[model samples]
Target: MKIPTAAGFVTLMLFCLVHAEICPLSCICKPLGEMKGWLVDCSSKGLKEVPALSVSTRKLYLQNNSMTTVRAGAFDNLRNLEEVNVSDNPWNCDCDILYLKLWLEDFSESSIANVICATPASNERKPLSQLSGNELDSCRKSLPIKCLDFFWRDLALITFAVLVLILTLCALRKHLRKIVLCV
Candidate 1:
């Protein structure tokens, strides 16, 4: 019933801070001894995309899922990750898988040996590391053409609207002058 001392409160806060681990949703996180790092296992959770991981994660397991392509820069924050397993997933080896390939080459080169493509018939069963940039899907190369198409369409619409507005203003000029004189 008595009030707790400041020392006891500080000890309680430190205990909570030491035990907290950033476990992602539907994932199991186990702390290494002495809190050296965490082993985040998110394998076979029916994951469509890679979940956000903590920076303290040293080992990550994300195999045997339905992931086709990971979003760009999804793994940019995991600087402390030592090992990652993303094999056995249906990886679409198109323009989208480039980010994962590049990140693996820089962070964990050995892991790339297990990443095999499952889609894009031409690249199917091919090792992601072995696929050259030129072999990617044609959509990436057509990006500039699509962008130019959008730009011209938008420009033509804007020009037509501006001309209509000018014509309407000119048509109302006589009425506007009369109204202004009365005011």
Candidate 2:
């Protein structure tokens, strides 16, 4: 049997450990289970967006970062996400953030209650779950007006159908009376 050289063995070990350190951009990737949450810290890395994380992340702390925007559907795939701390970032209050805010509102179990904004407008840390209808309206003001127009069109179609049904019933009743008089 041939014996492997020491250099060859070291190279194999390094290859196995490479995946644990290959984080995207300014973030660091580490096995959270291996370090007890101490090695997976992603806060204040000057991240402009939320980075993709492994499925094992149970708690994510993103406070005091330079994140300026969160794209729509950013966290759509994170089904296992239990907690998220996104306070103290320069969040742009705009329509793109509306989807995230709406989703956060629908999912009562989400923990995005402390996300603060620092640009375009400064306000206290706002709870995503508490965003009201007026806030949604303000965000949606710049969106295409076709969405509302379509809603009205649908309503008109339903009303027309109901009116047609009522008119048909009236004509049927009048015809039945004429037949009874002729008999």
Residue pairs clashing in model 1 are none
Q: What's model 1's overall lDDT?
A: 0.87
Q: Candidate 1's residue-wise lDDT over 3-70, tens digit each?
A: 87999999988866654547777888898766678998999999999987788889999999999999
lDDT of each: 0.87, 0.64
Whole-model alpha-carbon lDDT for candidate 2: 0.64
Clashing pairs in 2: none
Candidate with the greatest lDDT versus the true structure: 1
Positional deviation of residue 102's Cα in model 1 after best superposition, in angstroms? 0.4
The TM-scores of all predictions, comma-separated, are 0.66, 0.58
Error of 2 at 83 (Å): 2.7
